[model samples]
Target: MANTNLKHSSPQGGRLRSAVAITAILSLYSASAMADGGMASMCFFITYMKQIVGSVAVIAIFVWVMGYFEKKAVLADIGQYVVLGCMIAAMAGWFVSQAGLVPPSCSA
Candidate 1:
């Protein structure tokens, strides 16, 4: 009697699984995208960015303090850029939040 205990191997090198996973993810995203006009996702992104801005600002301040003790002008310069980035990110987040205040003219 011939042994038939071999495991089945896919010929497509996992592509089939990857394709199915991508399709499922896209379907879920589309369903979510249709809900709330995407406000939930936008708010989530805004909140995340706000947190990141705060964290980056603190790190930049720490960098500035370290530069002060090290007396390295380069570190101070880098810190300046890092702080500038945090400020810009914060401003962007504020702008997005404020935009939510006024309803669109086309909305009924």
Candidate 2:
């Protein structure tokens, strides 16, 4: 009789665990790389992120309007994208604050 207790090795068995471990290692490496700059991430979040969000909002509105006139998009379908853009623009400040990236004071 053949042994039924033998474990069969599969090609996909460890893929998920390997991926998670690799991701964790990469995350740690990136975090360490960013650690050298101290406030670098904060500065980037404060200065560049706001501008990016605002630009996205402007672009979203422009595209939505253009599509509306061209008859390529329905009003109902486009509302979500426009609303999301506006919401992101509106919340840019809050998002920055949440990221804890207050710029250094000039008094120093």
Candidate 3:
């Protein structure tokens, strides 16, 4: 039989599928936001980034908790780094808002 194992063993297919799915979802979201209005587009972009950062923070907290329980020094160190990154992201977002890079979407 021909070497079919090599073709089946590659992870490229899975990666490609994931890439395509993410691209499609992002494109759809962008298109919908654009259809809404310029303000909506800007707000959507900001909201999306905030959500992504928030998600990373949550994941980091989870890792930190797991590391604490397991007593793995390396994992705990990585968790600290992730937490720092989350803090930086939050600061950057705040800075952008303060700088008026984008108009405020919601009223105080």
Question: Using TM-score as the measure, which candidate wins?
Answer: 3
Across 1-23, the per-residue lDDT of candidate 2 in tens digits comes to 64445366454756876998978
Clashes per model (N, Cα, C within 3 A): 0, 0, 0
Tally clashes: model 2. Answer: 0
Q: What's the lDDT for residue 60 in model 2?
A: 72
Can you list the residue pairs that collide in candidate 1? none
List the global CA lDDT of all models.
Answer: 0.70, 0.63, 0.83
* Per-residue C-alpha lDDT of model 3 across residues 1-108, encoded as one tens digit per residue: 754676675688678979999999988998999999988887887788788888998998889888899998877888899999989989987887778786767321
Which residue runs of candidate 2 sit more than 4 Å off their true CA positions? 1-36, 74-76, 79-83, 95-108
Which number leads on lDDT? 3
What TM-score fits each model? 0.53, 0.44, 0.70
Worst 10 residues of 1 by lDDT: 99-108
Return the TM-score for candidate 1, rounded to 2 decimals: 0.53
Q: Sort all candidates by TM-score, best to worst.
A: 3, 1, 2
Model 2 compared with the native: what TM-score? 0.44
RMSD of each: 11.6, 10.1, 4.2
Judge candidate 2 at residue 102 and give its lDDT: 58
